[model samples]
Target: MREKLQHVAGRVWLYPHDPDPEAIGACVGVIADDRGSVLIDAGNSPAHAREVQQAIAAEGLPAPRWLVYTHHHWDHTWGAAAWPDVEVVAHSSAVDLLTAEAERPWSHQYLRDQVALDPKLGPSFRARALAVPDFGELAIVLPHRTFDDALTLPTGVELRHVGGSHAPDSIVALDPGSSVLLVGDCYYPPPFHLRTDDDGPDLAMARRLLAEKHAVSVDAHSAPRSGS
Candidate 1:
């Protein structure tokens, strides 16, 4: 079932609540107006992608015109293939990661672990997921537009690409009118695990970034927090 997060204005739908916490990472974003909507990050698989699509549809908003990848993690970018012909945007470094030749081995290993941990993923789904080409093979269709620092799309939404914090090309989105910020993976609450491969900025810096915006901030793993 899709879980909806309530906000004073607009709403956020979180995806995949299966037994395994990492099975399908959540996709976050808002729905408003008729021109279209914005999606923060795509989920882990095509199945998760469909769930996100359905969630967005249920919100009664137009199909997403712009989809932003908060980072280039396989869990975040793989489902992008299911999003159709939307204008996908990401940081320049994310684009590079998605287009790099060395991504497949790491991506395959990650997906394999996710599938193993969640038998709910099943064999057929695992096969299909494994078949999809890695980021380097599908970069052309994945993220067509890339930005360095900050870029604003239509509808008063601004996406600021902050240098590698959680990953090499992490980004955060801010809706000035709503004063809501969508940050993926950079600010997980408590019980923090220190993994060697985790790159980019630290949670403290992420907190500082949220503080600077003075917007209500939502981390990828938890509910929204007051930026103040």
Candidate 2:
């Protein structure tokens, strides 16, 4: 919960992830150009989103005109509602799951009930929810736009769906201007919520890496790795 936005390059700024296991949060990116600015992920809650906005504003950065999701996970998509003015975008496959979450009441009790019934909604997830100033203010905003394969923004950012074990609907955003690839959590193992030991996605990801021959692989939760 600190003002930690780091400039990656040209038009890319990264808000690094919070390392606390109990209330983890993923990295977020801001890519801006004359056409418009785009937010890579919405953060974990309304407060988290607000903090990002404030950080950008404090630095005199352009306010994001679009918010994109890498996948439909609480840590990534829960703060969508905070950026009401920006259009929310995600992969086509993420719509159903996100829409279902959007229908749920935004309250601590509701989340507690879900935790009791679903192992996937584990304690770590709940801890983050509790960290929110007002859990009732939590909201799941659905995507305003979606793409099956790729979408090229006016700013020259490319978003491509690259399904992986972490989340099938995972998408990576590449800022051509900066050569920064926002891979979200796709490179990581299934999160704590899923609690699985499946490495199938890892193998598939390796194959994808070989097929594309990417120069480097940047994970949302970890440092960049050499794709070579």
Clashing pairs in 1: 164-200, 165-200, 165-201
Report the Cα lDDT for residue 225, model 2. Answer: 51
Clashes of each: 3, 0
The TM-score values for the models, in the order shown, are: 0.73, 0.87
- State the lDDT of candidate 1 residue by residue for 41-134, as single tens digits: 8766555677778766775667888888888765676677788867888988876677772344545566677568765544434543543545
lDDT of 2 at 38: 95
Model 1 steric clash total: 3
**Root-mean-square deviation of Cα positions for candidate 2 versus the true structure, in angstroms:** 2.5
TM-score of 2: 0.87
Worst 10 residues of 1 by lDDT: 188-197
lDDT of 2 by residue, 1-228 (tens): 565677776678877777766676777788976566899999888878888888787767887888989999888987887886898889999999888877867576777778888868776557666557586677778888999999987777899998877788999988765666778887667766665655434766656655664554556666555554
Please give the RMSD to the true structure for each candidate, in Å: 6.1, 2.5
